[model samples]
Target: MKCSAPLALASATRGRPREFDPDQALAAALQVFWRRGYESASMAELTEAMGITKPSLYACFGNKEALFKKALDLYERDKLKYIGTALEAKTAHEVAERLLNCALATHCGASDPQGCLGVISMVGCTAEAESIRADVVARRASSEAAVVRRFEQAKADGDLPESVCPTKLASCLMTVLQGLSVKAQGGAKREDLQGAIDTFLTMWPRR
Candidate 1:
C-alpha cells in the first residue's frame, strides 16, 4: 500500500540517515493552516500535524510565513484545479457554472475542512500579518485577472454579450465566490449556498 512504502523507506534508511516525505509533511501542514488560518496556526501545531521536528520544519520549509505560503501553493495546485478547467468551458455561463459547482463541492466536502484556506487567511489575518495578507490579496488579484481575461475572450467570441463589462462581471463573480467561502466558514448549510448560486446563475446575463 502507499502507506507501507513510506514506512519501508524509513526502515531502510534507519541507521544511515533521517528522512521524511516532504509532500506528506506539506499536505499535513496545509491541513493545519486550512483549519486554523495563518496567524492562528502556531509553529507547534504545524510541526505536530506535519509529524516533523521544529528543526526539520525550519530546515525544510523555513519559518511560519514561508511554510504558510508553501501550504497555500499546495492548496491552489491541488484543491483549485477546477479554475483552470473552468476557463476551458465553451461559454461564459458554463465557465461560471463549473466554477461554482466545483467550489461548492470543495467547500462542502465531508472529509476536508470547511471553507477556503485563502479566504480564511485573508479574514483571520491581523495587523502583524500584513505581509501574508498582501500575498493572499495579490494571488487573488492574479486569479481575478485571469477570469477577466477569459470573460474578455468570451465577449469577443460572442459567448458573452457586448453590453457586459468583462472586468465588472469578473469582479461580481469573484464576490459571489468569496461570499460562498465566508458563508461556508460561518456554518452556512450546503443547500442554502446552492440556492444562492442558483439565484446568481439565474441573474447571469445570457449571450
Candidate 2:
C-alpha cells in the first residue's frame, strides 16, 4: 500500500502533528479514483476517503494531479503487473492468453472495484485535463507496442503465419482487452468475459 511519493515520509518527519499511514491513505485514494474519474474526484472527497485533512494530503501527496499520478502508478504496479510477465510467455499465443485471462480475473474479481481504473480514469477527462488523458493514452500505447513486438518475434520464430501483420494483430488484441474492461465495468460476469477470451484466442495467428 505504500506509495512512491517521497513527500509522505518527509512530511511525517517534519512534525505534522498527526499520525497517518501513507500506504493506507494512498490505498483509499486509489479506490476513490477508481470509483470516480480523475476530474470528478474532488479534493474534498479525496481527503474524506483518505481520512486526512487537506493540509495533510498536500504534505503527503502533493496536488491533485500529482496524487492521481501516484495513484495511477500504484494501480499499474499492483493491478497490471501481469502484462510484463505475460510478455515472457513461451509463445505469442500464450502471451495473449495469459494477458487476456489475467485481465478478466483482475477486472471481474470480487475484492476490487469493477472495470479498469486505467481505462476509465481518462475516458472523459475535462478539456483542462487533456495532459492527464494523454498520459494514460501514452501508457496504453506502450503496452500495445509491447504486444506488437512480441508478435513480431513470434512471426520471426515461425510461430505465426507469414501472412499475419503483427501490428494489426496486436491492435485487435488490445481492442478486445479494452472492450472487455468496459464490459466488465458495465457488469459483465467473469464467466462471460472468460468465454469471450476463449473465443478470441481461437483466432490467434497460427503457423
Candidate 3:
C-alpha cells in the first residue's frame, strides 16, 4: 500500500474553532462508534474520544448522524480494500477466498478494534437510528451485489460451473462473512475464523 499524508484542515473550519487533527479525530470517532454502536455513543463520548468540543465536532463533521456516516466512509475506505481487489481475481472461488480471508484478518487484527464497524453499528439499534442502520444495510447489500456481479462474470468466462447460481452463492458467502464478523466481535481467535474460511472455501463451486 502507498503511504499518504494526513488531511490538513482549512483555517476556521466551517467558521468554528478547530482544536485537533481532523483525521485523528475522525479515527477516534470511528473507534467510538465501532465499540459503542450508533445510538449508544453520545456527543459527550464522541467529543471526549475525538479530543474536540461539541462545536468543533459539529463544525468538522456536522451532526451525529453525519459524523457517523463520515466515520463509516473512512472505515470502508481504509478497511475494505480487499473487496475491490477480490473482484479482480481470476476466478469466483479466488474472489470469495480473498474476501473471506481479508475479512477474518481485518476483524481479528490486533491493531484495530474487534469485529466490523458495519456489523457493530446495527446490532440492537433503535428506530431513531434507522437511517444509519439502513445505510449500513445498503452498504452490505452493495458489497454482496458486487460479489454476485463478479460471480456472474466468472460464470460468463467459464470459471464457474454453468449450473451454479451466482446470486445464491454470493448471498451464502456474505452470510458467512456477517456471521464471522459477529464471532470475531465475540472474541473468536484469528485461527478460528481462518478455519471457518477454509471450510467455506471447500464449498465453493468447482469447475
Index of the highest-lDDT prediction: 1
lDDT of all predictions, in order shown? 0.87, 0.85, 0.84
Poorest 10 consecutive residues by lDDT, candidate 2:
1-10
TM-scores of the candidates are 0.89, 0.90, 0.89
Off by over 4 Å in 3: 1-9, 12-17, 111-113
Which candidate number maximizes TM-score? 2
Candidate 3 residue lDDT tens string, 1-207: 111232454553344444578889999998888888888899999999988899877766778998899899999999998899989999888998899888877877755437788888877466688999899999999999999999999999999998999999899989898899889888777778888889879988799
**Candidate 1, 13: how far from true, in Å?**
11
Error of 2 at 205 (Å): 1.9
Q: Per-residue lDDT tens digits of candidate 2, residues 86-147? A: 99998989999999999988877756437788788767586787888888999999999999
Pairs that collide in candidate 3 are none
Candidate 2, residue 62: how far the Cα is off, in Å: 1.7
lDDT for each residue of candidate 1 in 1-207, tens digit (9 for 90 to 100): 122242224444434454678788989999989888898889999899888899887766667887788788889999998999999999999999999989999989966337888999998997688999999999999999999999999999999888999999999999999999999888898999999999999999997
Residue 108 shift from truth in candidate 2, angstroms: 1.0
Model 2 regions more than 4 Å off: 1-14, 111-113
1 versus 3: better lDDT goes to: 1
